[model samples]
Target chain A: MIETKNLRFSYNGMEVLKGVDFKGEKGEFIGILGPNGAGKTTFLRCLAGILDCRGVFVRGKPLNEYSPRDLARIVAYVPQRVEPSFLTVFDTVLLGRRPYMGLTPSDSDIKTVEEALKRLGIEHLSLKRTNEISGGELQKVSIARALAQEPQILLMDEPTNNLDLRSQLEVMRLARELANDGKTVVTVMHDVNLALRFAKRFLFMKDGKKMADGGLEVLNERLFEEVYGVKVEIGEIGGVLVVVPI
Target chain B: MPMDYEAYTRRKAFIGLILFLSLLVVSLFSLSSGPYHVPLREVLGILFGGGTKDDRLVVLSIRLPRIVAGILVGASMGIAGAVLQGYLRNPLATPFTMGVSNGSMFGASLAIILGAGYSLNSGQVFLNNPYAVVLFAFLGAISATLVILALARLRGLSPEAIVLAGVAMSSLYVALTTLVQYFANEVQLSAMIYWSFGNLARATWRENAIMGVSFILVFFYFILKRWDLNASTLGDDIAKSVGVNIERERLVGTLLSAFITSVTVAFVGVIGFIGLIAPHSMRLIAGGDYRSLIPLSALAGALLLVSADTMARLIVSPMNLPVGVITSFLGAPTFIYLLVKMEGRR
Candidate 1:
C-alpha cells in the first residue's frame, strides 16, 4: 500500500499543497480530479519523492529515508508530456531498467523492455525516434517506460491530456488492466465520466485542499457545485456516475 | 514501413565509416611526401624497420609526432564536443561554447606576455616544464566552467539556461582575451596572436603518448555513461524517475568535458568550431545514439583535423597556415549551409 499523511508543499512562499492526506491500497485504481493550479501535479510529485515536502510519510518511513533510486524502484512516475529531442523508443523504454542494471543491461532486461513495449502496442515504433512519433504514441511510449520499471505503485499526471478518442480509451483500458494485475494505480484525469468508469475510488481537490474523497455515489450535483464553485448536473448512465457543467 | 532497406543502409554506412577511418590513417603517413620529397619506401622503412639516420629522424621526429598530435587533439575535441552536446541536449553546445577556448587563449597570451613561452626554449623544458602556460590554461578553463555552471543554477540548470550561460561566458572571455592583446608588445602580441590561431608543430612523442592514453580512457568512460546521457535529454524529472542521479551525472560529465578540453587547449592553442560542428555532423549521420555517435564523432573529428592540417601545410607551400584558420574557413561555410538546409527542411 502507498499512503501519504499530511503532505504539505510550498513554492516561492506560496502554498501549493496544504496538509493533504491520501491513501491507495494494492489493486486499487484512484483518480484525482482538480482544476488548473489545484496542486494535482505537485501532490503527485510529492508522492513520487520528486519534490521535498513537509509532513510526508510513506510506508511508515519518512520521505527522506529512501534515496531517489529506491523511491523510483517502488513508484514509477509518468509525466503529462515528455518531448525528448534525441532518443529511440526502445532506448527510452530501456532507461526504465536503469535502477536494476548497474553498468550494462542483461538479457532479462531486454526481455522486460520488449514485453512492456508489446503490452503498450508500440513494438513497431520501438526503432523510431521519440521526437518523430506523434503525441499519442509518445504518451504510450512514456507509459511503457514506466511499466517497464515494474513498480508496484504507478503515478500518472494527466496522462490522457493530448490523446484522441480511441487513444484515450486504449489508455484507460490499459490502466484498468494494470489495476487488475494488482498494481496500485493513481492517475489524474479531467474527464469525470472516464474517471468514474475506470477508478473505484476518487479524490476531488479545490484551492489546494481535498474537497471530498469517496466512492462514485458520494459525488453529487451539490458536492460538484461546492467543490468547483460552478453549477454542474450530475446523473447516472449505465450504472456509472458522471458530472456535466450546467 | 519496411525494415530491410534501413538495415542495409545502416550496415553500409557503418562499413563506409570504418573504411574511411582506415584511409585517413594511411593519408596521415602520406602527408610526409610533399615538397620534402621523402620517398615512400624510406617512409615505410622508417615506420616498420630501422632506416637511414636522416630518414628515421624526419619520419620519427617530425612527421610522426605531428600526425599523432593531430589524431589525439582531433579525437579529444570530438569526444568532448559529443559529451557536451549530449549533456546540454543542444546542437550548438560545445566545450568551446562554455568559454574554454577563449579562456585558454587568454591564459596562453598572458604566459607569452610574461615571457613564459620563451622560458621553455632549453629543449629539455618539456621534461622539466616550469612555465605556467598549461597550468594557467587549465585554471582558466575550470574557472570558466564554474562560472557557466553557476549561472546555469539560477534557472535550475535547464538546457536553455546552460546554453545562455555558455554564450555569456564566451563573450566575456573574448573581451578579456582582447584586453590581453591590447597591452602586449609587437613581438609578444604577434606570438600570442599566432598561438591563439593554433598550431601543432610543437608535438612531441611524450605529449602524444599522454594525450592518447587520456583520450582512450575518457572515451571509454563516456561510452559507459552513454545511457545516462540518453535518459537526461528526456528532462530531469523523467531521468530521475528512471533512476538516474541527474545532478551527479551532470557534474561528472561537465568535469570530464572540461578536463579533456583543458588538456587539448593547453597543448594546441585555441581551435574553435571543431568541438561544435563535429558532434552535430555525427548526429546527422549516425542518428543521435550516443553509443554510436561518440566513437564515430571521434573518428570523424580526428580525420577532419588531420586532413585540414595537411591542407594547411600544402595550401601555402612552405609557409604553413594556422590549422585553426583552415578549420574556420572550411567549417563556417559548411555550418551556414547546414543551417540553411535545416531551415529549409523545417
Candidate 2:
C-alpha cells in the first residue's frame, strides 16, 4: 500500500500541492483526473520519491526511510516521454533490471526482459534502435521496461500523451491488465471518459488540492464543473459511466 | 528463444571488438617493421622473450613502449568520450569539450615557459616529472569542471548550459596557452608547438606501466557504474525514479573521466578527435548501451590511433608527422560522412 498525508509542495514560492491526503491499496487501479496545472505530475513524482514533499508515506513507512533502489524495487515509474538517444529496444527494456543486476546482467535478468517484451507484444522490435522507432512503439517499450522491474506498484505520468487513439487505448488496456494481474496502478489521465471507463477509483484535483476522491458514481456534473470549471455531461452507457463535455 | 536477441547482439559486438583488438596488435607489429626491417619473428621474440640486445633496445625501448602508450591513451580518451556522450545524451560531448585538453595544454605550456622543471633541478625541462604534470593537469581539468558546473547551476543544470560553459572555458584556455607560447623562448616555443601537435615518442616503459594500470582501474570503475550512467541519459527525474543517485553518480563519473583525460593529456599532449569521434562511431555501430559501447569504443579507439600513429611514422618516413594531425585528417572526413549519413537516414 502507498499513502500520503498532508502532502504539500511549493516551487518558487508557488504551491503545487496543498495538504493532500491520498492512499492506494494493493491491486488497486486508481486514475488521477485533473485540469492542466492541477499538480498530478507533482503528486506522482512525490509518490515515486523523485520530488521532496512535506508528507509522503509508502507501505506505512516514511518516504525518506526508503532508498532510491528500494523505492524502485517497490514502485516502477513510466514517464510520459522517454526519448532515448540511441539505445535499442532490448537494451532499453533490459535497463529495468538495473537494480537487480551488477556489472553484467544475469540470465535470469535476460529472461525477465524477454518476458516483458513478450508481454508488451514488442518482441519483434527487440533489435530495433529506440530512436528510430515510432512514438507509439517507444511508449510500449517504455512500459515494458517498467514491467521488467517487477515492481508491486506502477506509476505512469500521462503515459498516452503523444500517442494516437489506438496507441492510447492499447496503453490503457495494458494498464488495466496490469492491475488485473495484482499490481497496483496509479495513472494520471487527461481523458476523463477513459479514466471513468477503466479506473476503479477516481482522484479529481483542482488548484493544487483534491476536489473529489471516490468511485465513478461520486463523479457527477456538479463535481466536474467545480473541479474543471466547465460544464460536463455525465450519464450511464451500457452499465459504464460516460463523461462528455457539454 | 528467437536466438536470444540481446545475447546475440552482445556476442556479435564482443567478437567484433576482439577482431578490432587483433587488428590493433597487427598495426603495432607493422609499426616496427618499416625500412629498418625488423622481422615479425624477431618482433614477436622481443615482445615475449628477450631478444638480441640491439633488437630488444629497438623494439622494447623505442617502438613497444610508444605503441603501448598509444593504445592506453587511445583507449582512455575513447572511453572518456563514450562516458561523456552517454552522460550528456549528446553525440558531440567529449572530455575536450569540458576544457580538459585546452586547460592541460595551458598548464603544461605555462610550466615550460616559466621553466618550472629546471628550477626544480630536473635535467630535462617541460615538467618531466610525471606526478607534477598529472597534478597540474588534474587541477586544470577540475577547475574547468567546476566552472561548467557553476554555469549549469545558473540554468537549473541543463546540458546546454554545461556545454556553453565548456566552450567558453575552452576558448579562454586556448587563448591563454597561445599567450604563454607568444612569450616563450625559442626552445620553449618549439617544445610547446610540438607538444600541441601531440606525439607518442616520449612513451617510456615506466610511463606505459603507469598509464596501463590507471586505464585498467578507471575502465573497471566505469564498467561497475555502467547502469547508473545508462539511467542518467534518461534525464534526472526518470533516473531518480529508477533508483539512481544522480548527483553522486555524475560526480564520480565526471571525476574519473577527467582524471583519465588529464593523465592522457599530461603524457601525450592533445590527441584531438579520437575522444570525440571514436565513441560516436561506436554508438552508430553498437547503439547506446554503455555495457557494450564502452568496451567497443575503447578497442576501436586503440585500433584507430595505433593505425594512425603507424601511418604518421611511415607516411613521412624518418620525419614522423604528429599523430594528432593524422587522426584529424582521418577523423574529419569520417565525421562528415556520418553527419551526412544521419541526415540522409532522417
Q: TM-scores of the models, in the given order?
A: 0.91, 0.92
Q: Which stretches of candidate 1 lie over 4 Å from their true place?
A: A54-58, A238-240, B1-20, B23-31, B39-41, B117-130, B150-156, B337-346
DockQ of every model listed? 0.48, 0.63
Who wins the DockQ comparison?
Answer: 2
Q: Model 2, B1-346: lDDT tens per residue?
A: 5476747676757756674868657665764576576887778777787678987877877887788888899899899988987777666788888899889888877766655443223423354454555556557665787777655556456665666778889999999988988888767776566557778876788878888898999999888878887887777766777788886676567667777877778777778888877787777777677877788878878878888888888897877888989999888898788766655432
Residue pairs in collision within model 1? none
- Give interface RMSD, per candidate: 2.8, 1.7
Task: Output the number of the TM-score-best candidate.
Answer: 2
Q: How well does model 2 score by local distance difference test?
A: 0.80
Q: Candidate 2, which segments miss by more than 4 Å at Cα?
A: A237-239, B10-14, B17-21, B116-135, B149-156, B185-187, B342-346
lDDT of 2 at B141: 61
* CA-only RMSD, every prediction: 3.5, 3.1
Predicted complex 1: CAPRI docking category: acceptable
Candidate 2 residue B194 C-alpha distance from true site, Å: 2.5
For model 2, how does the per-residue alpha-carbon lDDT over A34-62 read when each residue is reduced to its tens digit?
A: 89999999999898888877588888999
